[model samples]
Target: MTQHIQEAYGYIFEPKLIEDLCIVAAELDFKEGDQLIEIGQYIKKMPLLLNGVIKIMREDPDEGELLLYFIEKGDTCAMALTCCMGSSKSDIRAIAETDGTVLMVPIEKMEEWMTKYRSWRNFVINSYNNRLKEMLLAIDNLAFMKMEDRILNYLKEKSKLAANNTLNITHQEIANDLNTSRVVVSRILKKLENEKQIKLNRKSIDLAL
Candidate 1:
Protein backbone atom coordinates (compact mmCIF):
# COMPACT_ATOMS: atom_id res chain seq x y z
CA MET A 1 0.00 0.00 0.00
CA THR A 2 1.12 3.55 -0.66
CA GLN A 3 1.59 5.87 2.33
CA HIS A 4 -1.04 8.19 0.92
CA ILE A 5 -3.80 5.63 1.43
CA GLN A 6 -3.10 5.49 5.17
CA GLU A 7 -3.05 9.27 5.17
CA ALA A 8 -6.38 9.40 3.34
CA TYR A 9 -8.62 6.54 4.53
CA GLY A 10 -7.23 5.19 7.77
CA TYR A 11 -10.75 4.38 8.88
CA ILE A 12 -11.03 1.42 6.45
CA PHE A 13 -8.75 -0.72 8.55
CA GLU A 14 -10.63 -0.23 11.78
CA PRO A 15 -12.65 -3.04 13.33
CA LYS A 16 -15.95 -1.30 12.61
CA LEU A 17 -17.26 -3.13 9.52
CA ILE A 18 -15.68 -6.55 10.00
CA GLU A 19 -18.47 -8.28 11.91
CA ASP A 20 -21.19 -8.86 9.33
CA LEU A 21 -19.29 -8.43 6.09
CA CYS A 22 -16.93 -10.98 4.63
CA ILE A 23 -14.11 -8.65 3.79
CA VAL A 24 -12.24 -10.02 0.78
CA ALA A 25 -9.42 -7.55 0.87
CA ALA A 26 -6.40 -8.68 -1.12
CA GLU A 27 -3.32 -7.14 -2.71
CA LEU A 28 -3.94 -7.41 -6.45
CA ASP A 29 -1.12 -6.32 -8.73
CA PHE A 30 -1.12 -5.27 -12.43
CA LYS A 31 1.35 -3.97 -14.96
CA GLU A 32 1.37 -0.73 -16.92
CA GLY A 33 -1.07 -0.46 -19.86
CA ASP A 34 -3.21 -3.23 -18.44
CA GLN A 35 -6.96 -2.65 -18.64
CA LEU A 36 -8.47 -3.45 -15.27
CA ILE A 37 -11.90 -2.64 -16.62
CA GLU A 38 -13.61 -1.77 -19.89
CA ILE A 39 -16.32 0.70 -20.82
CA GLY A 40 -19.94 -0.42 -20.19
CA GLN A 41 -18.88 -3.33 -18.01
CA TYR A 42 -21.17 -3.87 -15.07
CA ILE A 43 -19.34 -2.48 -12.08
CA LYS A 44 -20.41 -4.99 -9.46
CA LYS A 45 -17.49 -4.23 -7.19
CA MET A 46 -15.54 -1.28 -5.86
CA PRO A 47 -11.75 -1.34 -6.12
CA LEU A 48 -9.42 0.45 -3.75
CA LEU A 49 -5.94 1.00 -5.04
CA LEU A 50 -3.32 -0.10 -2.57
CA ASN A 51 -0.34 1.09 -4.62
CA GLY A 52 0.61 2.58 -8.00
CA VAL A 53 -1.92 4.44 -10.14
CA ILE A 54 -5.11 4.05 -12.18
CA LYS A 55 -7.09 6.33 -14.50
CA ILE A 56 -10.87 6.50 -14.90
CA MET A 57 -11.50 7.44 -18.53
CA ARG A 58 -14.64 7.89 -20.58
CA GLU A 59 -15.00 6.51 -24.10
CA ASP A 60 -16.80 8.33 -26.89
CA PRO A 61 -18.56 5.92 -29.15
CA ASP A 62 -19.81 8.80 -31.27
CA GLU A 63 -16.39 10.36 -31.69
CA GLY A 64 -14.67 6.98 -31.82
CA GLU A 65 -12.18 7.70 -29.02
CA LEU A 66 -11.62 8.32 -25.30
CA LEU A 67 -10.81 11.01 -22.74
CA LEU A 68 -8.73 10.22 -19.69
CA TYR A 69 -8.67 11.56 -16.13
CA PHE A 70 -6.58 9.94 -13.48
CA ILE A 71 -7.89 8.37 -10.31
CA GLU A 72 -4.91 7.93 -8.08
CA LYS A 73 -4.33 5.37 -5.39
CA GLY A 74 -6.86 5.46 -2.55
CA ASP A 75 -9.66 6.30 -4.98
CA THR A 76 -12.60 3.99 -5.55
CA CYS A 77 -13.13 2.54 -9.03
CA ALA A 78 -16.93 2.25 -8.97
CA MET A 79 -19.24 5.12 -8.07
CA ALA A 80 -21.99 2.56 -7.65
CA LEU A 81 -24.42 4.48 -5.49
CA THR A 82 -24.77 7.38 -7.92
CA CYS A 83 -25.36 5.16 -10.97
CA CYS A 84 -27.43 2.66 -8.98
CA MET A 85 -30.30 5.12 -9.30
CA GLY A 86 -30.32 5.56 -13.08
CA SER A 87 -28.65 5.06 -16.58
CA SER A 88 -24.97 5.47 -15.79
CA LYS A 89 -23.68 8.97 -16.22
CA SER A 90 -20.21 7.76 -17.32
CA ASP A 91 -18.71 4.61 -18.71
CA ILE A 92 -15.50 3.88 -16.80
CA ARG A 93 -12.30 2.38 -18.18
CA ALA A 94 -9.80 1.66 -15.44
CA ILE A 95 -6.31 1.81 -16.88
CA ALA A 96 -3.35 0.67 -14.87
CA GLU A 97 -1.21 3.66 -15.75
CA THR A 98 1.65 2.05 -13.90
CA ASP A 99 2.00 -1.20 -12.05
CA GLY A 100 -0.84 -1.32 -9.47
CA THR A 101 -2.19 -3.15 -6.51
CA VAL A 102 -5.73 -2.98 -5.14
CA LEU A 103 -8.28 -4.30 -2.66
CA MET A 104 -11.62 -5.41 -4.06
CA VAL A 105 -14.97 -5.18 -2.32
CA PRO A 106 -18.00 -6.69 -4.02
CA ILE A 107 -21.18 -4.62 -3.91
CA GLU A 108 -23.23 -7.56 -2.74
CA LYS A 109 -21.12 -7.78 0.43
CA MET A 110 -21.65 -4.10 1.04
CA GLU A 111 -25.39 -4.43 0.44
CA GLU A 112 -25.54 -7.22 3.01
CA TRP A 113 -23.70 -5.07 5.51
CA MET A 114 -25.99 -2.14 4.81
CA THR A 115 -29.00 -4.30 5.58
CA LYS A 116 -27.56 -5.99 8.66
CA TYR A 117 -25.40 -3.37 10.35
CA ARG A 118 -25.82 0.28 11.14
CA SER A 119 -22.06 0.89 11.17
CA TRP A 120 -21.87 -0.06 7.50
CA ARG A 121 -23.19 3.40 6.77
CA ASN A 122 -19.85 4.74 7.91
CA PHE A 123 -18.11 3.06 5.00
CA VAL A 124 -20.64 4.42 2.53
CA ILE A 125 -20.34 7.90 4.02
CA ASN A 126 -16.56 7.72 3.91
CA SER A 127 -16.54 6.55 0.30
CA TYR A 128 -18.80 9.40 -0.83
CA ASN A 129 -16.80 11.93 1.14
CA ASN A 130 -13.54 10.90 -0.46
CA ARG A 131 -15.05 10.82 -3.94
CA LEU A 132 -16.63 14.22 -3.40
CA LYS A 133 -13.38 15.71 -2.18
CA GLU A 134 -11.66 14.46 -5.33
CA MET A 135 -14.42 15.82 -7.57
CA LEU A 136 -14.27 19.22 -5.89
CA LEU A 137 -10.54 19.31 -6.25
CA ALA A 138 -10.92 18.50 -9.93
CA ILE A 139 -13.38 21.35 -10.32
CA ASP A 140 -11.08 23.76 -8.55
CA ASN A 141 -8.21 22.84 -10.82
CA LEU A 142 -10.23 23.18 -13.99
CA ALA A 143 -11.50 26.59 -12.89
CA PHE A 144 -8.31 28.09 -11.50
CA MET A 145 -5.48 26.46 -13.42
CA LYS A 146 -4.29 27.40 -16.88
CA MET A 147 -3.94 24.57 -19.35
CA GLU A 148 -0.22 24.24 -18.68
CA ASP A 149 -0.77 24.46 -14.95
CA ARG A 150 -3.40 21.76 -15.18
CA ILE A 151 -1.01 19.52 -17.09
CA LEU A 152 1.77 20.28 -14.63
CA ASN A 153 -0.44 19.55 -11.66
CA TYR A 154 -1.74 16.39 -13.27
CA LEU A 155 1.77 15.06 -13.94
CA LYS A 156 2.98 16.03 -10.47
CA GLU A 157 0.02 14.31 -8.81
CA LYS A 158 0.42 11.18 -10.88
CA SER A 159 4.17 11.11 -10.31
CA LYS A 160 3.66 11.19 -6.56
CA LEU A 161 0.94 8.55 -6.72
CA ALA A 162 3.17 6.36 -8.92
CA ALA A 163 5.72 6.21 -6.07
CA ASN A 164 8.39 7.64 -8.33
CA ASN A 165 9.52 10.86 -9.93
CA THR A 166 8.53 9.38 -13.28
CA LEU A 167 5.07 9.34 -14.86
CA ASN A 168 3.69 6.76 -17.27
CA ILE A 169 1.09 8.59 -19.32
CA THR A 170 0.37 9.03 -22.98
CA HIS A 171 0.25 12.59 -24.32
CA GLN A 172 -2.84 11.93 -26.41
CA GLU A 173 -4.60 10.47 -23.41
CA ILE A 174 -3.66 13.50 -21.31
CA ALA A 175 -4.90 15.82 -24.02
CA ASN A 176 -8.20 14.01 -23.99
CA ASP A 177 -8.22 14.12 -20.20
CA LEU A 178 -7.68 17.88 -20.15
CA ASN A 179 -10.12 18.50 -23.02
CA THR A 180 -7.34 20.04 -25.05
CA SER A 181 -5.86 19.23 -28.42
CA ARG A 182 -3.04 16.71 -28.81
CA VAL A 183 -0.73 19.14 -30.61
CA VAL A 184 -1.19 21.62 -27.80
CA VAL A 185 -0.30 18.98 -25.26
CA SER A 186 2.81 18.14 -27.26
CA ARG A 187 3.84 21.80 -27.30
CA ILE A 188 3.30 22.07 -23.56
CA LEU A 189 5.35 18.97 -23.00
CA LYS A 190 8.13 20.43 -25.08
CA LYS A 191 8.05 23.57 -22.94
CA LEU A 192 8.20 21.48 -19.77
CA GLU A 193 11.17 19.58 -21.20
CA ASN A 194 12.99 22.80 -22.13
CA GLU A 195 12.41 24.11 -18.61
CA LYS A 196 14.03 20.97 -17.19
CA GLN A 197 10.79 20.17 -15.34
CA ILE A 198 10.21 16.88 -17.15
CA LYS A 199 11.48 14.52 -19.85
CA LEU A 200 8.81 13.22 -22.17
CA ASN A 201 9.15 10.14 -24.31
CA ARG A 202 6.82 8.06 -26.41
CA LYS A 203 4.56 6.70 -23.64
CA SER A 204 5.79 8.15 -20.36
CA ILE A 205 7.24 11.17 -18.61
CA ASP A 206 10.24 11.47 -16.32
CA LEU A 207 8.89 14.15 -13.98
CA ALA A 208 11.66 16.17 -12.41
CA LEU A 209 9.60 16.95 -9.34
Candidate 2:
Protein backbone atom coordinates (compact mmCIF):
# COMPACT_ATOMS: atom_id res chain seq x y z
CA MET A 1 0.00 0.00 0.00
CA THR A 2 2.81 2.36 0.89
CA GLN A 3 4.58 1.56 -2.36
CA HIS A 4 1.37 2.10 -4.31
CA ILE A 5 0.78 5.46 -2.65
CA GLN A 6 4.35 6.55 -3.35
CA GLU A 7 4.07 5.50 -6.97
CA ALA A 8 0.64 7.04 -7.56
CA TYR A 9 0.44 10.20 -5.45
CA GLY A 10 3.96 10.69 -4.10
CA TYR A 11 5.17 13.05 -6.81
CA ILE A 12 2.21 15.35 -6.21
CA PHE A 13 3.24 16.08 -2.63
CA GLU A 14 6.38 16.97 -0.79
CA PRO A 15 8.21 14.17 0.95
CA LYS A 16 7.02 15.26 4.36
CA LEU A 17 3.50 15.73 3.11
CA ILE A 18 3.55 12.34 1.48
CA GLU A 19 4.90 10.79 4.61
CA ASP A 20 2.24 12.46 6.68
CA LEU A 21 -0.49 11.32 4.27
CA CYS A 22 0.68 7.72 4.33
CA ILE A 23 0.63 7.75 8.08
CA VAL A 24 -3.01 8.85 8.26
CA ALA A 25 -4.47 7.65 5.00
CA ALA A 26 -6.28 4.37 4.97
CA GLU A 27 -6.12 2.15 1.93
CA LEU A 28 -9.34 0.92 0.31
CA ASP A 29 -9.91 -1.40 -2.62
CA PHE A 30 -12.95 -1.31 -4.87
CA LYS A 31 -14.24 -3.69 -7.45
CA GLU A 32 -15.88 -2.79 -10.72
CA GLY A 33 -19.36 -1.24 -10.32
CA ASP A 34 -18.76 -0.31 -6.71
CA GLN A 35 -20.21 3.00 -5.64
CA LEU A 36 -17.67 5.40 -4.17
CA ILE A 37 -20.18 8.10 -3.42
CA GLU A 38 -23.93 8.38 -3.67
CA ILE A 39 -26.14 11.34 -4.40
CA GLY A 40 -27.41 13.27 -1.37
CA GLN A 41 -24.95 11.55 0.95
CA TYR A 42 -22.43 13.26 3.15
CA ILE A 43 -18.80 12.72 2.18
CA LYS A 44 -16.37 12.03 4.99
CA LYS A 45 -13.09 11.43 3.18
CA MET A 46 -11.34 12.22 -0.06
CA PRO A 47 -9.76 9.58 -2.23
CA LEU A 48 -6.42 9.60 -4.02
CA LEU A 49 -6.65 6.93 -6.64
CA LEU A 50 -3.81 4.44 -6.78
CA ASN A 51 -4.99 2.57 -9.85
CA GLY A 52 -8.01 1.88 -12.09
CA VAL A 53 -10.87 4.07 -13.31
CA ILE A 54 -13.75 5.81 -11.56
CA LYS A 55 -16.78 7.24 -13.34
CA ILE A 56 -18.26 10.47 -12.02
CA MET A 57 -21.93 11.01 -12.62
CA ARG A 58 -24.62 13.61 -12.11
CA GLU A 59 -28.07 12.50 -11.07
CA ASP A 60 -31.48 14.06 -11.50
CA PRO A 61 -34.94 12.97 -10.50
CA ASP A 62 -36.59 13.52 -13.85
CA GLU A 63 -33.65 13.12 -16.20
CA GLY A 64 -31.99 10.30 -14.30
CA GLU A 65 -28.19 10.20 -14.39
CA LEU A 66 -25.46 11.17 -16.84
CA LEU A 67 -21.80 10.44 -16.99
CA LEU A 68 -19.84 13.56 -16.03
CA TYR A 69 -16.21 12.49 -16.22
CA PHE A 70 -13.69 9.83 -15.37
CA ILE A 71 -11.11 9.71 -12.61
CA GLU A 72 -8.16 7.43 -13.29
CA LYS A 73 -4.94 6.38 -11.69
CA GLY A 74 -3.06 9.18 -9.97
CA ASP A 75 -6.16 11.35 -10.06
CA THR A 76 -8.52 12.77 -7.44
CA CYS A 77 -12.21 13.60 -7.73
CA ALA A 78 -12.90 17.33 -7.73
CA MET A 79 -16.40 16.82 -6.35
CA ALA A 80 -14.97 14.89 -3.46
CA LEU A 81 -12.68 17.79 -2.67
CA THR A 82 -15.56 20.24 -2.63
CA CYS A 83 -17.77 18.07 -0.48
CA CYS A 84 -14.99 17.35 1.95
CA MET A 85 -14.23 21.02 2.35
CA GLY A 86 -17.68 21.84 3.66
CA SER A 87 -20.72 20.34 5.38
CA SER A 88 -22.60 19.92 2.13
CA LYS A 89 -23.89 16.57 0.92
CA SER A 90 -22.83 14.95 -2.33
CA ASP A 91 -24.71 16.07 -5.38
CA ILE A 92 -23.16 13.45 -7.64
CA ARG A 93 -22.11 9.84 -7.61
CA ALA A 94 -18.80 8.10 -8.25
CA ILE A 95 -18.52 4.48 -9.27
CA ALA A 96 -15.57 2.21 -9.74
CA GLU A 97 -15.23 1.60 -13.46
CA THR A 98 -12.62 -1.01 -12.79
CA ASP A 99 -11.02 -2.75 -9.87
CA GLY A 100 -8.80 -0.21 -8.14
CA THR A 101 -7.13 0.98 -4.99
CA VAL A 102 -7.22 4.36 -3.29
CA LEU A 103 -5.62 6.10 -0.36
CA MET A 104 -8.36 7.89 1.53
CA VAL A 105 -7.44 10.90 3.60
CA PRO A 106 -9.82 11.79 6.39
CA ILE A 107 -11.69 15.04 5.94
CA GLU A 108 -9.77 16.57 8.83
CA LYS A 109 -6.45 15.69 7.28
CA MET A 110 -7.47 17.12 3.95
CA GLU A 111 -8.25 20.49 5.52
CA GLU A 112 -5.12 20.45 7.58
CA TRP A 113 -2.93 19.53 4.62
CA MET A 114 -4.27 22.46 2.64
CA THR A 115 -2.57 24.91 4.98
CA LYS A 116 0.21 22.68 6.22
CA TYR A 117 1.43 21.48 2.81
CA ARG A 118 2.12 23.41 -0.34
CA SER A 119 1.79 20.30 -2.49
CA TRP A 120 -1.72 19.63 -1.25
CA ARG A 121 -2.83 23.13 -2.24
CA ASN A 122 -1.30 22.72 -5.67
CA PHE A 123 -2.88 19.32 -6.13
CA VAL A 124 -6.28 20.62 -5.12
CA ILE A 125 -6.05 23.58 -7.47
CA ASN A 126 -4.79 21.55 -10.42
CA SER A 127 -7.36 18.82 -9.90
CA TYR A 128 -10.19 21.32 -9.77
CA ASN A 129 -8.93 23.07 -12.89
CA ASN A 130 -8.64 19.83 -14.81
CA ARG A 131 -12.10 18.66 -13.81
CA LEU A 132 -13.60 22.01 -14.70
CA LYS A 133 -12.02 21.80 -18.13
CA GLU A 134 -13.46 18.36 -18.66
CA MET A 135 -16.93 19.47 -17.61
CA LEU A 136 -16.75 22.50 -19.87
CA LEU A 137 -15.78 20.27 -22.77
CA ALA A 138 -18.76 18.07 -22.02
CA ILE A 139 -21.06 21.05 -22.04
CA ASP A 140 -19.54 22.29 -25.28
CA ASN A 141 -20.07 18.94 -26.91
CA LEU A 142 -23.70 18.92 -25.90
CA ALA A 143 -24.24 22.47 -27.10
CA PHE A 144 -22.26 22.64 -30.33
CA MET A 145 -21.87 19.06 -31.58
CA LYS A 146 -24.38 16.90 -33.38
CA MET A 147 -25.61 13.63 -31.92
CA GLU A 148 -23.45 11.57 -34.26
CA ASP A 149 -20.34 13.40 -33.25
CA ARG A 150 -21.30 13.20 -29.60
CA ILE A 151 -21.79 9.45 -29.84
CA LEU A 152 -18.47 9.01 -31.54
CA ASN A 153 -16.72 11.12 -28.94
CA TYR A 154 -18.37 9.19 -26.14
CA LEU A 155 -17.27 5.87 -27.64
CA LYS A 156 -13.75 7.17 -28.09
CA GLU A 157 -13.58 8.28 -24.49
CA LYS A 158 -14.93 4.94 -23.27
CA SER A 159 -12.33 3.11 -25.33
CA LYS A 160 -9.59 5.28 -23.94
CA LEU A 161 -10.73 4.74 -20.36
CA ALA A 162 -10.95 0.99 -20.85
CA ALA A 163 -7.59 0.97 -22.63
CA ASN A 164 -8.97 -0.85 -25.64
CA ASN A 165 -10.42 -0.15 -29.06
CA THR A 166 -13.02 -2.84 -28.53
CA LEU A 167 -15.64 -1.98 -25.92
CA ASN A 168 -17.77 -4.55 -24.15
CA ILE A 169 -20.87 -2.39 -23.76
CA THR A 170 -24.42 -2.49 -24.97
CA HIS A 171 -26.26 0.09 -27.03
CA GLN A 172 -28.73 0.60 -24.22
CA GLU A 173 -25.85 1.34 -21.85
CA ILE A 174 -24.61 3.98 -24.24
CA ALA A 175 -28.06 5.48 -24.42
CA ASN A 176 -28.29 5.65 -20.65
CA ASP A 177 -24.94 7.37 -20.39
CA LEU A 178 -25.90 9.90 -23.03
CA ASN A 179 -29.42 10.33 -21.65
CA THR A 180 -31.00 9.38 -24.95
CA SER A 181 -33.39 6.73 -26.16
CA ARG A 182 -32.19 3.20 -26.79
CA VAL A 183 -33.69 3.21 -30.27
CA VAL A 184 -31.81 6.39 -31.12
CA VAL A 185 -28.58 4.95 -29.82
CA SER A 186 -29.06 1.75 -31.82
CA ARG A 187 -29.83 3.66 -34.99
CA ILE A 188 -26.80 5.88 -34.63
CA LEU A 189 -24.61 2.88 -33.88
CA LYS A 190 -25.86 1.15 -37.00
CA LYS A 191 -25.07 4.21 -39.04
CA LEU A 192 -21.58 4.32 -37.66
CA GLU A 193 -21.15 0.63 -38.45
CA ASN A 194 -22.32 1.13 -42.02
CA GLU A 195 -19.76 3.87 -42.40
CA LYS A 196 -17.08 1.48 -41.14
CA GLN A 197 -16.39 3.66 -38.16
CA ILE A 198 -17.30 0.94 -35.72
CA LYS A 199 -18.30 -2.69 -35.80
CA LEU A 200 -21.15 -3.86 -33.63
CA ASN A 201 -21.69 -7.30 -32.17
CA ARG A 202 -23.58 -8.80 -29.27
CA LYS A 203 -23.13 -6.31 -26.44
CA SER A 204 -19.88 -5.05 -27.90
CA ILE A 205 -18.47 -2.37 -30.19
CA ASP A 206 -15.18 -2.56 -32.07
CA LEU A 207 -13.72 0.76 -33.15
CA ALA A 208 -12.38 0.75 -36.69
CA LEU A 209 -10.52 4.00 -36.20
Candidate 3:
Protein backbone atom coordinates (compact mmCIF):
# COMPACT_ATOMS: atom_id res chain seq x y z
CA MET A 1 0.00 0.00 0.00
CA THR A 2 2.88 2.38 0.77
CA GLN A 3 4.92 3.86 -2.07
CA HIS A 4 8.03 2.04 -0.93
CA ILE A 5 6.19 -1.29 -0.91
CA GLN A 6 4.99 -0.69 -4.45
CA GLU A 7 8.47 0.32 -5.55
CA ALA A 8 10.21 -2.66 -3.96
CA TYR A 9 7.58 -5.04 -5.35
CA GLY A 10 8.17 -3.64 -8.79
CA TYR A 11 11.87 -4.39 -8.49
CA ILE A 12 11.25 -7.98 -7.38
CA PHE A 13 8.53 -8.95 -9.82
CA GLU A 14 6.37 -7.78 -12.65
CA PRO A 15 3.02 -6.21 -11.72
CA LYS A 16 1.09 -9.37 -12.56
CA LEU A 17 3.43 -11.51 -10.48
CA ILE A 18 2.97 -9.08 -7.62
CA GLU A 19 -0.75 -9.47 -7.99
CA ASP A 20 -0.48 -13.24 -7.92
CA LEU A 21 1.92 -13.15 -5.01
CA CYS A 22 -0.45 -10.88 -3.12
CA ILE A 23 -3.24 -13.36 -3.64
CA VAL A 24 -1.33 -15.87 -1.54
CA ALA A 25 0.42 -13.46 0.84
CA ALA A 26 -1.28 -12.71 4.13
CA GLU A 27 -0.97 -9.35 5.80
CA LEU A 28 -0.50 -9.05 9.54
CA ASP A 29 -0.16 -6.04 11.81
CA PHE A 30 2.09 -6.63 14.78
CA LYS A 31 2.38 -4.63 17.96
CA GLU A 32 5.59 -3.90 19.82
CA GLY A 33 7.12 -6.97 21.51
CA ASP A 34 5.23 -9.37 19.25
CA GLN A 35 7.10 -12.55 18.28
CA LEU A 36 6.50 -13.21 14.60
CA ILE A 37 8.42 -16.47 14.64
CA GLU A 38 9.72 -18.52 17.52
CA ILE A 39 13.12 -20.14 17.23
CA GLY A 40 12.36 -23.74 16.20
CA GLN A 41 8.91 -23.14 14.78
CA TYR A 42 7.99 -24.55 11.39
CA ILE A 43 8.63 -21.43 9.35
CA LYS A 44 7.04 -21.88 5.93
CA LYS A 45 7.06 -18.39 4.48
CA MET A 46 9.19 -15.29 4.13
CA PRO A 47 7.72 -12.17 5.72
CA LEU A 48 8.18 -8.88 3.89
CA LEU A 49 8.43 -6.04 6.34
CA LEU A 50 5.87 -3.41 5.41
CA ASN A 51 6.19 -1.06 8.36
CA GLY A 52 8.39 -0.73 11.43
CA VAL A 53 11.67 -2.35 12.46
CA ILE A 54 12.15 -5.94 13.53
CA LYS A 55 15.27 -7.37 15.13
CA ILE A 56 16.43 -10.79 14.08
CA MET A 57 18.24 -11.91 17.21
CA ARG A 58 19.69 -15.08 18.62
CA GLU A 59 19.83 -15.22 22.40
CA ASP A 60 22.61 -16.45 24.60
CA PRO A 61 21.56 -17.36 28.13
CA ASP A 62 24.97 -16.20 29.36
CA GLU A 63 25.87 -13.26 27.09
CA GLY A 64 22.28 -12.07 26.39
CA GLU A 65 21.02 -11.55 22.83
CA LEU A 66 23.11 -11.20 19.68
CA LEU A 67 21.37 -9.07 17.09
CA LEU A 68 21.88 -10.33 13.55
CA TYR A 69 20.26 -7.36 11.90
CA PHE A 70 17.18 -5.18 11.87
CA ILE A 71 14.68 -5.74 9.08
CA GLU A 72 13.00 -2.54 8.03
CA LYS A 73 10.29 -1.86 5.49
CA GLY A 74 10.76 -3.75 2.19
CA ASP A 75 13.18 -6.24 3.76
CA THR A 76 12.51 -9.96 3.83
CA CYS A 77 12.87 -12.26 6.87
CA ALA A 78 13.14 -15.99 6.53
CA MET A 79 15.64 -18.80 7.15
CA ALA A 80 15.14 -20.84 4.02
CA LEU A 81 18.15 -23.18 4.11
CA THR A 82 17.59 -23.83 7.78
CA CYS A 83 14.10 -25.00 7.00
CA CYS A 84 15.34 -27.18 4.17
CA MET A 85 18.01 -28.77 6.34
CA GLY A 86 15.53 -30.12 8.90
CA SER A 87 13.32 -29.12 11.80
CA SER A 88 16.19 -29.59 14.23
CA LYS A 89 17.29 -26.01 13.78
CA SER A 90 15.88 -23.36 16.10
CA ASP A 91 12.92 -21.64 14.52
CA ILE A 92 14.00 -18.12 13.67
CA ARG A 93 11.94 -15.36 15.29
CA ALA A 94 11.29 -11.79 14.17
CA ILE A 95 10.64 -9.69 17.23
CA ALA A 96 8.88 -6.40 16.75
CA GLU A 97 11.73 -4.33 18.07
CA THR A 98 9.08 -1.79 17.18
CA ASP A 99 5.53 -2.14 15.86
CA GLY A 100 5.35 -3.20 12.18
CA THR A 101 3.32 -4.82 9.42
CA VAL A 102 4.43 -7.87 7.45
CA LEU A 103 3.39 -9.68 4.29
CA MET A 104 3.77 -13.40 4.83
CA VAL A 105 4.50 -15.04 1.49
CA PRO A 106 4.69 -18.79 1.19
CA ILE A 107 8.09 -20.25 0.33
CA GLU A 108 6.57 -22.26 -2.49
CA LYS A 109 5.45 -19.11 -4.23
CA MET A 110 8.89 -17.63 -3.80
CA GLU A 111 10.45 -20.67 -5.42
CA GLU A 112 7.94 -20.50 -8.19
CA TRP A 113 8.76 -16.88 -8.83
CA MET A 114 12.49 -17.62 -8.80
CA THR A 115 11.99 -20.20 -11.48
CA LYS A 116 9.81 -17.91 -13.55
CA TYR A 117 11.84 -14.68 -13.21
CA ARG A 118 15.58 -14.70 -13.85
CA SER A 119 16.24 -11.27 -12.39
CA TRP A 120 14.31 -11.93 -9.20
CA ARG A 121 15.93 -15.30 -8.84
CA ASN A 122 19.41 -13.78 -9.09
CA PHE A 123 18.40 -11.10 -6.59
CA VAL A 124 17.34 -13.66 -4.01
CA ILE A 125 20.49 -15.70 -4.54
CA ASN A 126 22.67 -12.63 -4.12
CA SER A 127 20.80 -11.55 -1.02
CA TYR A 128 21.21 -14.94 0.62
CA ASN A 129 24.92 -15.04 -0.20
CA ASN A 130 25.46 -11.51 1.05
CA ARG A 131 23.81 -12.15 4.38
CA LEU A 132 25.88 -15.29 4.83
CA LYS A 133 29.10 -13.46 4.02
CA GLU A 134 28.29 -10.64 6.42
CA MET A 135 27.62 -13.09 9.22
CA LEU A 136 30.88 -14.89 8.60
CA LEU A 137 32.84 -11.64 8.40
CA ALA A 138 31.36 -10.42 11.66
CA ILE A 139 32.35 -13.62 13.42
CA ASP A 140 35.87 -13.44 12.01
CA ASN A 141 36.25 -9.83 13.07
CA LEU A 142 35.10 -10.54 16.59
CA ALA A 143 37.31 -13.56 16.97
CA PHE A 144 40.57 -12.16 15.60
CA MET A 145 40.41 -8.40 16.07
CA LYS A 146 41.29 -6.36 19.12
CA MET A 147 38.55 -4.55 21.03
CA GLU A 148 39.80 -1.03 20.28
CA ASP A 149 40.33 -1.94 16.63
CA ARG A 150 36.81 -3.26 16.30
CA ILE A 151 35.26 -0.22 17.98
CA LEU A 152 37.25 2.22 15.87
CA ASN A 153 36.45 0.26 12.72
CA TYR A 154 32.78 0.26 13.61
CA LEU A 155 32.80 4.02 14.13
CA LYS A 156 34.67 4.65 10.87
CA GLU A 157 32.26 2.52 8.81
CA LYS A 158 29.21 4.04 10.46
CA SER A 159 30.60 7.54 10.01
CA LYS A 160 31.08 6.92 6.30
CA LEU A 161 27.49 5.72 5.87
CA ALA A 162 26.11 8.49 8.06
CA ALA A 163 26.08 12.00 6.63
CA ASN A 164 28.03 13.41 9.58
CA ASN A 165 30.15 12.10 12.43
CA THR A 166 27.28 12.49 14.86
CA LEU A 167 25.84 9.03 14.51
CA ASN A 168 22.63 8.73 16.53
CA ILE A 169 23.45 5.47 18.23
CA THR A 170 23.42 4.21 21.79
CA HIS A 171 26.10 2.20 23.60
CA GLN A 172 23.61 -0.58 24.29
CA GLU A 173 22.60 -0.82 20.65
CA ILE A 174 26.23 -0.95 19.55
CA ALA A 175 26.91 -3.77 22.00
CA ASN A 176 24.00 -5.78 20.63
CA ASP A 177 25.37 -5.39 17.11
CA LEU A 178 28.88 -6.23 18.22
CA ASN A 179 27.76 -9.33 20.12
CA THR A 180 29.22 -8.19 23.39
CA SER A 181 28.12 -6.97 26.79
CA ARG A 182 27.09 -3.37 27.32
CA VAL A 183 29.74 -3.03 30.01
CA VAL A 184 32.51 -3.91 27.56
CA VAL A 185 31.08 -1.55 24.96
CA SER A 186 30.82 1.24 27.52
CA ARG A 187 34.37 0.66 28.70
CA ILE A 188 35.75 0.86 25.18
CA LEU A 189 33.66 3.95 24.49
CA LYS A 190 34.91 5.64 27.61
CA LYS A 191 38.48 4.98 26.53
CA LEU A 192 37.74 6.39 23.07
CA GLU A 193 36.11 9.48 24.56
CA ASN A 194 39.06 10.14 26.84
CA GLU A 195 41.34 9.94 23.79
CA LYS A 196 39.10 12.38 21.85
CA GLN A 197 38.10 9.71 19.38
CA ILE A 198 34.39 10.26 20.01
CA LYS A 199 32.08 12.26 22.25
CA LEU A 200 29.70 10.16 24.28
CA ASN A 201 26.41 11.47 25.48
CA ARG A 202 23.04 10.39 26.76
CA LYS A 203 20.89 8.61 24.09
CA SER A 204 23.41 9.21 21.26
CA ILE A 205 27.08 9.56 20.34
CA ASP A 206 28.95 12.20 18.37
CA LEU A 207 31.73 10.96 16.11
CA ALA A 208 35.08 12.61 16.53
CA LEU A 209 38.11 12.48 14.29
Best by TM-score: 2
- Model 3 scores a C-alpha lDDT of 0.70
TM-score of 1: 0.70
Q: Sorted on lDDT, highest at the top, how do the candidates line up?
A: 2, 3, 1
Q: Compute each candidate's TM-score over C-alphas.
A: 0.70, 0.96, 0.74
Candidate 2: global Cα-lDDT? 0.89
Clashes of 1: 0
Q: Per-residue lDDT tens digits of candidate 2, residues 1-209? A: 66887888777877888778778989999999899899999989898999999999997899977888999989999988899898689988998889999888899888888899888899999999999999898888778988899899999998998889999988887888888889999999999999999999987899996
Candidate 1 pairs with clashing backbones: none
Cα lDDT, model 1, residue 12: 63
Q: State the lDDT at 203 in candidate 1.
A: 75
Q: Which ten residues in a row have the lowest lDDT in candidate 2?
A: 9-18
| Model 2: CA > 4 A from native | none
Model with the higher lDDT, candidate 1 or 3: 3
Q: Can you write out model 1's per-residue Cα lDDT over 1-209, one digit (the tens) per residue?
A: 33434543555644444422223544568998898877666655566666677776666666544434566655664454445324364366677877867666666666666666554556567767776676677778767878888889887876666677866678887787777788999999999899999997777799885
**Better candidate by lDDT, 1 or 2:** 2
lDDT (10s digit) by residue, model 3, range 1-209: 53545666666656676676567878889997798777767776767777777767777768766656556665665454346334345545567866778877776777778778776576577667766776676677768988788878877766664446887777877787677778999999999999988898887778776
